[model samples]
Target: MTFEAELRKGNFQVAECTNCKKTVWPPSDFCNQCFKEIHWRKCANEGKIIEFSKQNNYYFCLVEFENTIKVIGKISSGIPNKDQHVRIKRCGMTDDNYFFEFSLI
Candidate 1:
């Protein structure tokens, strides 16, 4: 149902550019940054949250991967930006996973 769930289940795939060195979280054939054909790789289910926003009872987090790829996800639990480290927590339910703008112990 959610984009993060889709990605975790492998229903949704992402792509990154090896040329201009950009990552496309939703996966695209063309690089939006360089306007070039994209060469992509599969991502492991891990990333760090760099930013977050709350709206209308919904929390959104911006997740950054190793290749500088950024994806937005939801925070199912914990306080944002309190730990000073960017981290994402994956739960078994997929829906329960929380992405935070800071790390947690």
Candidate 2:
């Protein structure tokens, strides 16, 4: 299945270049570097919190997965710290944007 299709099912997938073995961010059908075809694979569930901010009662953070894909998601519970490890608790499309919820690992 495609990226959007899989994401809609709460499965996070990444696009990787088959020839160069490099991950392509933003999920493309073709690799940006070699212009080769891409293959879809499940992304690592765990990520490191790059940065975070508190809004109202919730904490939102920028998390990096596989050292390549960075996404903004909300903390499911507890206060987050820099470079803290987190796991994807929930993810799916929200209207036109993607939404992710993370929990400390």
The segments of candidate 2 whose C-alpha lies over 4 angstroms from its true place after superposition are none
- Residue-level lDDT of model 1, residues 4-101, one tens digit each, is 55445543335666678677545577777887777645554566557778877766777666746665666665656621344445422345652332
Best by TM-score: 2
Weakest 10 consecutive residues of candidate 1 by summed lDDT: 96-105
lDDT per residue for candidate 2 within 35-91, as digits (tens), equals: 999999999999999999999999999999999999999999999999999999999
Candidate 1 global lDDT: 0.56
What candidate 1 gets wrong by more than 4 Å, as runs, is: 1-9, 16-26, 30-40, 82-105
RMSD of each: 6.1, 1.0
Q: Which residue pairs does candidate 2 place in steric collision?
A: none
